[model samples]
Target: MGLLFLTIFLTDFFGYTDALLRFDRVRRKVWMFVGTRSPIELDWDRLTPVSQGITPANSNVNTFRSVLLVDLDAEGDVKFDGKYPRIASIGQTSLNEQQAISQYEYVRQFMELGPTHLPSCETYLEHRTVFRDIVRFFGFLDLARNIDWRRPGETGGGLLVLASILCMLLGWAFLPFDLATYIAYRCNRVPKWPAKIEAYAKDGGEMTTPVGAASGRMRIVLKEVPFILLWVGCAFAVYAWVASWFIK
Candidate 1:
């Protein structure tokens, strides 16, 4: 069952559907599609002098080091072209960036939005990202493995030590790290994309509720609460384990 769950989780983690940025030459419209639904549509005229740029990935993959996009405006303002401003990559990730870059070149070659310039974002990536969570989990497991189980007099006592280490790491290190990085990301991305839109743009937000924003927030809570609760359980385990040891 554990293996089955890991298998399923891995599938979902790595799985991607068809995401396309399509241009309707006849209609002069750009449609951004995820699977069958067109999430965003922009008239070709809405974007101009398409600009190509790479910014540190604030919300997406981390390995790429940067998220590349095509900007329609000279300033590459997200507020101005809030529509489908970003072009789709041929594949995904840095390799995708190469393909996306080529695609950008291809689009700019014929469509002629305007002058082309390479732009970079001036902010840090988000902290509560899936990638970060995965990293954190594996990091803790690694830490757990390296723990000196014999140091605290017993293997069980070492569990308490492990828990304290993790709790301290979460409370002291990760908390501040998340805050600082998020602040930087927000400050840099405000002009590019508003806080409100940014909040709703991810899996964190849900569209099913009458209050779409509220639903999205709930989704984040649901995804996040488990991690929190897991840590809390570990903390309790640590306390109980230590207390039992002392009692004896």
Candidate 2:
């Protein structure tokens, strides 16, 4: 148990800490280039266009007029058109129509030309790589599950099993055991937080999952309970073994 606790403390603190640092580095890199904090959103944008394209393929007719004539309402969804008009106008705009046509043509050209400069391309590629790294990191879980466990001896097996158990136990102790479920509940109930706490004041205090509940529990059990129990067990075992020598 002494060995088990030591192993878990080292692995959880060092190994997991290293993994989290790498994850954060990739996350930061993705955010720095993509201009978004979310890695998942960044990944999605790479695979899917923010706005639909007005191509000859998607359009009914080959001519611009025919495509534009199809429907203004059908125009691709603008994600950040309001926020970044310059980027948005690159795809929107037309020569013939002043307001409507110009914007459409601008958008069309922007999509067709893509990013013009090398710096833009490099920035886009860097963000893409960061997104890919996030995906690959998540993929490692699958790889871990497939790894063979039988190769390790009894001591190794015990250590691995205990570490796995401790992680789960500690995680639950630190975080809300039902955190995922609580989040799901909140999502279904409120969907969004009220702009002001007063809005929900009429209804009892806003519900929050027992935050840090898991971490607190983990600290007590992993750092205190198990540490003491394991050390005491080791000491008792050592004393028992030595006592047998005297009796014999």
**lDDT (C-alpha) at residue 164 in model 2:** 45
Model 1 spans with C-alpha error above 4 angstroms: 1-17, 34-38, 48-76, 80-91, 95-100, 109-248
Error of 1 at 188 (Å): 34
Which segments of candidate 2 are over 4 A away from where they belong?
Answer: 1-73, 84-205, 210-217, 220-248
Q: Write the per-residue lDDT of candidate 1 for residues 112-176, one digit (tens) a residue.
A: 44212423223322212332332243344334434454575545445645765666445434444
Candidate 2's residue-wise lDDT over 57-123, tens digit each?
Answer: 7766433321121111234443342343212112233323344555444434433443231121111
Residue range with the least summed lDDT across 10 consecutive positions in model 1: 211-220
TM-score list, all predictions? 0.27, 0.17
lDDT of each: 0.44, 0.31
Best by lDDT: 1
Among all candidates shown, the one with the greatest TM-score:
1
**How far is each candidate from the true structure, as Cα RMSD in Å?**
17.3, 22.7
